[model samples]
Target: MADTHENAYDEFAEAYAAMNETGSWNAHYERPATLALAGEVAGLRVLDAGCGPGILTQELTRRGATVTGVDASEQMLGLARRRLGGSATFARADLGKPLPFADASFDLVTASLVMHYIEDWSVPLGEFRRVLTRDGRLVFSTHHPTMDFHISGADDYFATYQFDDEWFHGDIVMKMRFWHRPLRAMTRALGEAGFGIDVIDEPDPEESVRESEPRAWESLSTKPAFLFFRAFPRYSA
Candidate 1:
């Protein structure tokens, strides 16, 4: 990752977690859409990579998956531990480096809104492939290039680079950095990392959001706010 901020969420763990719990984009949109692609996680061993505050971990476990959450922020891990207790395992690990797991350790791996933080996908994608069983699928969600490019006001759509933004969680303001690359680059990175794309989705927000947050529902349903993918290893080792 070029603009490395390993503990980016550490300082705002509490505020972020609180916001994530019921945030229109997260709780109602991204999480639901991502989990739908995950399909039947029941009775499966899953890795929730970059699992902040165990939000998705809790949902995965609730759906009968044995979940292990990993993140670079110790503070976020603390919140995850407190939230899930013995329901899921957690460790402090950076996605830019090797993951601490044995080969073929999981049946599924999810990296929700996490990959954009790392400029390079090779290391983490390889690690995810390494840890997944032969039949395992990697399902993830990330910022849509269209959205990023629009927000960044970058001249070249094909260029891969980093950008900065600010997030507001209640009264707390968090400055964040993220990577932006064209759609082709994302797929290329997956192919080079030994994954074969099975599904590429631009999802609509769940119906529930229509009543609660009509504006977000309308915007998310019509626009490309995020991109989702479900891929499996191309050649099993």
Candidate 2:
């Protein structure tokens, strides 16, 4: 059987990709925030982990990063390959397992709204650290714990657990699962994986969305929809 973590994306790859292309939450909110955190990537070796549909990968490559995009869903990878067309390399790999890259293989690693799917951060995070150069950084975004707890209606904030939810894109609806852990737990996991946190951002929706997506702008501006982190490897002396 396929890993339950990845099956949902394969089922709605096309629909989700279409929606993500113009969706206010993705285009104006998460993607912009993530790219801002990445700063200048020209000439950097970037690994776009969980690079669904090549949306972020295309932008990274355009900004002069030699990117390698990886996703667990073949359907999504196919979409990515078609979208980029030899501009960047593509791979099929799961963040839940050891990444298929050599140590110090990349200058930056980016995971956009992908980490929440994995219940255990140890293996994936360690893999991120292992693949990144000494000076490299990992930039990622995920569903904010508080928001997820509210959406999940879970009683325990400190405990780590998976919750199921459904996503609607146009007329297509897909069920997905995500793991939720408290703020402390998230930071602790990163520290245990040898990453030193540099920035923890709770971004507001871009002003551009104010007129076009007023509701999204209002909600995201006032509440924490997602959390972003920029972390670097910390080696012991």
What does the lDDT come to for candidate 2? 0.92
Candidate 2: segments with Cα more than 4 A from true spot = 1-6
Winner by lDDT: 2
The per-model lDDT (C-alpha) reads 0.91, 0.92
Error of 2 at 80 (Å): 0.3
For candidate 1, write residues 1-237 as lDDT tens digits. Answer: 234454568888899898889989999889998899999999999999999999999999999999999988888999999999898999989898999899999999999999889888899999999999999999999999999999898999999999888887767888888899999999999999999999999888878889999999889988899999999998855
How would you encode candidate 2's per-residue C-alpha lDDT over 1-237 as one tens digit per residue?
033445999988899899889989999999999999999999999999999999999999999999999998899999999999999999999888988799999999999988898878898899999999999999999999999999899999999988888888767778888889999999999999999999999888878899998998889888899999999999999
* Reference-based TM-score, model 2: 0.97
Which parts of model 1 are misplaced by more than 4 Å?
1-6
Q: What is the lDDT of residue 22 in candidate 2?
A: 91
